[model samples]
Target: MTSTDELLVKEITVSRQSSGEERRLALHQIYVQVLERQPYAFERKQLAKIEADFLRNKIGVKRFLRELGHSEVYLNAFYYNSSNPKFIELCFKHFIGRAPSDQAEMRRYCDILMRQGVRDMITALLDSEDYSRHFGCFTVPHAWAEASYPSPRTFWETEVLLHELHGRRGWIVPTMVWHDLQLNCDGGSCRLPEPSLSSAPSSRTAAVISGSEALHQVLSTMGPQDLAAFAATLSTAERDKLRHLLMQSVQ
Candidate 1:
């Protein structure tokens, strides 16, 4: 796995002019990096169409991942097998490359999933500012637990949760349940440290006024449903800014 520092050094992408064998190799790498599947597993006809579309350059890494997030293979492996909280937690790791800092974060995505179904839920995640800031349309997502967690316990627990906790391994505990097990004590005998605001190393301290590609794409589409889905992806401050813009437009 490439360190975030290494990704900063050289963000990787497959060239359009690469040979067929090179394209196959690139696809294999994506399967391993994004899905955590065996290197050659993509060869056996899972998501063959998406693989071909990627090979044919019909979609970028971002869109390919968006498709993967809602696809049957992914849903079966991550979503259907685990509870909703656990599914959302896995999406954070797979799509955004981190454990959700807390349950409020999980609730947001979980709500998206419940109301909008897996496709729109995935759209919100892939279109998020977090995904753009970390991976953009090029590089594969990788664990940020090493550099991002606020304290030693957070780092340790998240590393364990992301890598070790899995339903296939019969570790059926969901995200916060696993966390609570670690943080909670019998008879209220312990005072667990409050998770710090600074803990989300990848999160912005404040919302910016500039519209993201998400907003711009909505503007381009000019469709009400796209507008709504795009809006769901915004932070509260961002939504406020957007609401103000819309209100002013009508006035």
Candidate 2:
């Protein structure tokens, strides 16, 4: 072939390779955004169809996400398969990269589920201005576990915060199984009394300190439920200060 013809062929080959790469990247992102967890054959097939349509311009990225959010696959996995409160929690984690910061936010979504239905609840989340501002259309939203905090908590603590909002409703009340557990029981059952503190220690109690110090003392003795309740009362800034104070004490 002539030099110009050879150059044209090389250009076409490069174009095709670039196109393939872009398509692959798009498909991977779609998989994560649409089905971050395990999927059955039918769910996988539907995602595949959606991906193909997205690539062909038959659907835009926003519509693609909306469709997946409203799909039976998503509903079954996040909504029907779990508690309604849990489903609401998952929606915030998956679509907004953070947990609901307040009980009111969670209650609002639960209200949607009760009044409108699952599909509309999903629609409300995906179509919200907050989702658009944070994640845009095609990006895969994930928990902000690695997010930089002035004072960060441990990994498990972060995970706990994701689903542990206080005053949240719709979760089944847990049975008090421990009420009947014998201390010397042999069927792998045991009950340990929880610790409690009637007063703060004298060393720090005599001196006036910032509320963070007092919070640290209360937090040091808190069970899971108490800790969650305390967390619910704090603003983001107060939470950060409390975490910082706790870490300082640990060090």
Query: By TM-score, who's the top model here?
Result: 1
Taking the tens digit of each residue's C-alpha lDDT, what string does model 2 give over 51-153? Answer: 6776665665567767788887777665653445556656765566455544456567868876898788888998887677655665444444344321232
Q: Which parts of model 1 have CA positions greater than 4 angstroms off?
A: 1-11, 15-22, 39-46, 149-154, 165-172, 183-251
Output the number of the lDDT-best candidate. 1
lDDT of each: 0.56, 0.49
Window of ten residues with lowest summed lDDT in model 1: 205-214
Which residue pairs show backbone clashes in model 2? none
lDDT of 1 by residue, 157-178 (tens): 4565455424432312333432
Summed over model 1, clashes come to 0
TM-score per candidate: 0.60, 0.52
CA error at residue 231 for candidate 1, angstroms:
36
Report the error of model 2 at residue 6, Å.
Answer: 46
